[model samples]
Target: MTAVTAPEEVARIQGRVVRVLALGQVLGGVAFGATVSLGALLAADISGQESLSGFATASVTLGAALCAIPLARLAAARGRRTALTLGNLFALVGIAIVVTAAALRVFPLLLAGVVLIGAGNAGNLQSRFAATDLAAGERRGRDLGTVVWATTVGGVLGPLLLTPGEALGRLVGMPPLTGAYLFSIVAQAAALILYLVALRPDPLLLAQRISRDAAGGAAPPVDADRPLAARYAMFAVAASHVVMASVMAMTPVHLQHLAHAGHGGAAGANEAVTLLVGTTIALHVLGMYGLSPVFGWLADRWGRVAVVLLGQGVLACALLLATFGSDVQGIVIVALFLLGLGWSAATVAGAALLTESTPVDLRPRRQGIGDTLMTSSAAVGAVLAGVVLGQWGYGALALVALVLVALTTVLSPLARR
Candidate 1:
């Protein structure tokens, strides 16, 4: 890459590129977000299995957890563009695996593919940070939010594709719903192309140059190689993501059970379940991404720690509300909405903080580690939620959420500046 440009020139060029990248983020997120929800649905439908759906979902997170930190280090050493391009490639491979598994009716292979897709997700999850790398400090959150909002189009549209995907799959003699994976492959490939075309010089390199300039062009101090807190923010940032992810994975499954058992063996149970899953996916995606800019902005202005605490507080209230109405779909929707919103707040803020807290040299490493922790913990949570639901039911799970909320109170002080 080239040396730093003047601030004004940097602003002009970087501003335009970041906007383009934001659009790319939205496109990628739409595909990825939809897949997360739809993959679980497809796994359940094709395998004629229920409990195993969570395992499929967990596989993706497990892959992500395994790969996130290493990828971050790679991006830090190489460039964000390189890392992202690699991610898209992984997604393409994962898609092919899923497609093959579906054709052959191989559940284990399908799960492996799901894990690979999750590995791609680990890369996709870092897009907001890529956006932040070029931002003019104050606008970080707003920029991040804009990209997230872009997902609204794809996130909603992905699930809506299910009916058509299934029909198409049947026409092709593949398992019903396997067609969705085909769409994902196309979307993810397009995403890879978008990054290749738009992310010139890469935002991470630009940021490194900018930081170098700000440090009087001297070798910048490595802030990232500090204490454990500076290096990880493990207990706080990772925990927030885990909680958010765990709950998201649990949501559709909960609704599915309710529809099956409580809806009086409804004739439209399958469709209803699909719709509920889609709606919840849409809502959760909206919640997580819709207000991302606001959170990014707040992280820059008020400090990331404050945003983390705010998110935790909102999450606590939302979980409490969920406990009151386990029987109502609307209640679950609202609670999940709040959960998504809370997650967005904490994640965006926490991510920004992690970046800010670390030295440039260490930023990527720490980011990867932090994200891996978050994803791994979320994977565990997903599996646990499924087991809990199988044994204790949704109502009992709500109590567990309440306990999680209580623990957040203890952690709230940790979020203070």
Candidate 2:
């Protein structure tokens, strides 16, 4: 690879890289979506404590936070491919442990398994950044967004597999939620194989080589403003994620309560409740990933800061809806949708801004730091969400999320030069 400098060559490589990453994301997303859809329910069942439900999802986020630095360091030292492969392997192990734990009904084992599964999520999230590694500055957002958008396919389909997963579990003599993990295991394994085979010449390494060649084999000086901008981007992404995760983690429980109360009537009863919850989660995921390309385009055209602010506005509206319309099913659906959309916007914009602002040599580390902070914030929010929902109701949790969203909005202006 003789330092691919031609514009056409860069475009070609970027396209190829994006395609590979997108396909991998689809596979990984399916595995992640399936696991996450039932994570809380499974936790409640295994622990026999409704209050501990959020811990399942929180542990996943926590695992991601813990793995971020190590993965980033590995990417910096080895390559993105290696780091991602290792993450998937961790997830595979997690899936096995979760399956076994479910069979044995061990709560601690279940939590442990979920944490490792989160390592897989860490890899999936990092793939978006890898898409930008060889991209033209002008097209970075589009490339990144395209990869993000690819997740929509698997995300939407993952929840739909719930019934089938349960059936599969029964057929195999496994527990109810265990079937979803089986699907996850297969999906994750396929993703690992695809990445190992297809991602050649490593995008990050290639970009680094090109940079060295352009600078006559010398490294560029670090940008003084990059660190501050990165911090802003990190904060923006973290706040948005915290809001999304906090509300999303508890929505199933909320719906379950409504189901028990017969708010929607017991016409179809169990079947109706399952359909409602599954559809809501599916739509929420669609909102999270379906329109990523649009946000990406806006990020590239209108600018990253503008998009971050836009995401904050959407999030504020979502929080308000959740707070005021807590009793309405339609309102909750809309609120969750907006929550996902806001997250997509903020995440895409924040990630693009962070990538563009960071130094090449330091990009992986900064990206890791950003992800760690983002996921950890979400983890805390998730753990607290269970308590909040138990004590003050979903409305109060939304209000808390609103405050955080507002704080991000106030900080958005600082991200710009």
Candidate 3:
């Protein structure tokens, strides 16, 4: 097949790829968002120990970290289509297992299922990279951000489904929490089908072909700056993720406690808490994805390092607010929103930097490695956040997250040329 070189032709293909990927993101995000929102609550209920709550979210992050390299290798060998489809399949099976585990009240089974769910997240994360495969450098961040923004639709919708999901569970005789997984199952299956059917003429393969043809079958020259830039990108993404996950993992449990204390013995107390938590989570999800396009544009316009630094600053401010405002509901909401925004800034900019800095032939491997590090860091934070929250309180956990944010700031200078 002739390699596509015309700018218009490239734009056409890129547009199609972005549209398909965005749609898939929306569908897949519903499942992921629902699962994450419920993960800690489910774990706490199942284990009967507040300290073990983080394990649920941690398992998902750990699973994603473990699957990153393997999925990247698979993409390299087969194609994006196959790798993404397989990842979703893993999540589908996982949701089923999670439902069964919930029914049986088995904690270990729940953890195992969540891990596989994390594998699906690995695939979702990688899909953003696929959007950039055929994009010009100037538009790379924008295209990728558009795909990221697409997640907002389902991400927001998923948490909002909490009440309905619970009702459905009661109607069907399933555990209340397991009802959300019913939505997850359908959403994941839809995403799997979308990838298999819509992602044709895979972007990575086409980009490779174009690269080879443009170079007359010779390899592109290596840039000395790439290795350093890639390293910085990994650090920025990972640090930002750690702060977000650590705080987010414990927020539900914190809210649960408040609900018990403030509304105990009141009629519809459970429903009231569910509404509040679901809204908070939905808004958080919106903050994570809603403004990605703006961040993407800023990354391209101001440069990647600038965006990363800006994200670190935002995160620092967020942590401070959380630290002092733990008992204030409005303050906590704003802080979580800022937390999501900071994560978005760092992640979008960092990912674009990594893509531009890496050699085309080595892109998949490097991207995988970067994702592994990022998710692994978040997993550690998630696990520790539980202990910190249980022992010290949410204020202390936010302080710890603040330290990591500061470390990212210290590393920002290294990312500069």
**Top candidate, metric TM-score:** 3
Per-residue accuracy of model 2 over 243-288 as CA lDDT, tens digit each:
9999998888787777767745666655555566777888999999
Candidate 3 global Cα RMSD:
1.8
> Candidate 2 regions off by >4 Å?
216-225, 263-270
For candidate 2, what is the total of clashing residue pairs?
A: 0
Give a tens-digit lDDT track for model 3, residues 68-96. Answer: 99999998878889889999988998888
Q: How would you encode candidate 1's per-residue C-alpha lDDT over 349-415 as one tens digit per residue?
A: 7776666566665667777878788888778877787777677766676568656555655665544
Residue 148's lDDT within candidate 1 is 59
Error of 2 at 130 (Å): 0.2
Full candidate order by lDDT, most accurate first: 3, 2, 1
Please rank every candidate by TM-score, starting with the best.
Answer: 3, 2, 1
Local distance difference test, each candidate: 0.73, 0.86, 0.88
Residue-level lDDT for 25 in candidate 3: 93
Compare candidates 1 and 2 on TM-score and give the better one. 2
In terms of TM-score, how similar is model 2 to the real structure? Answer: 0.96
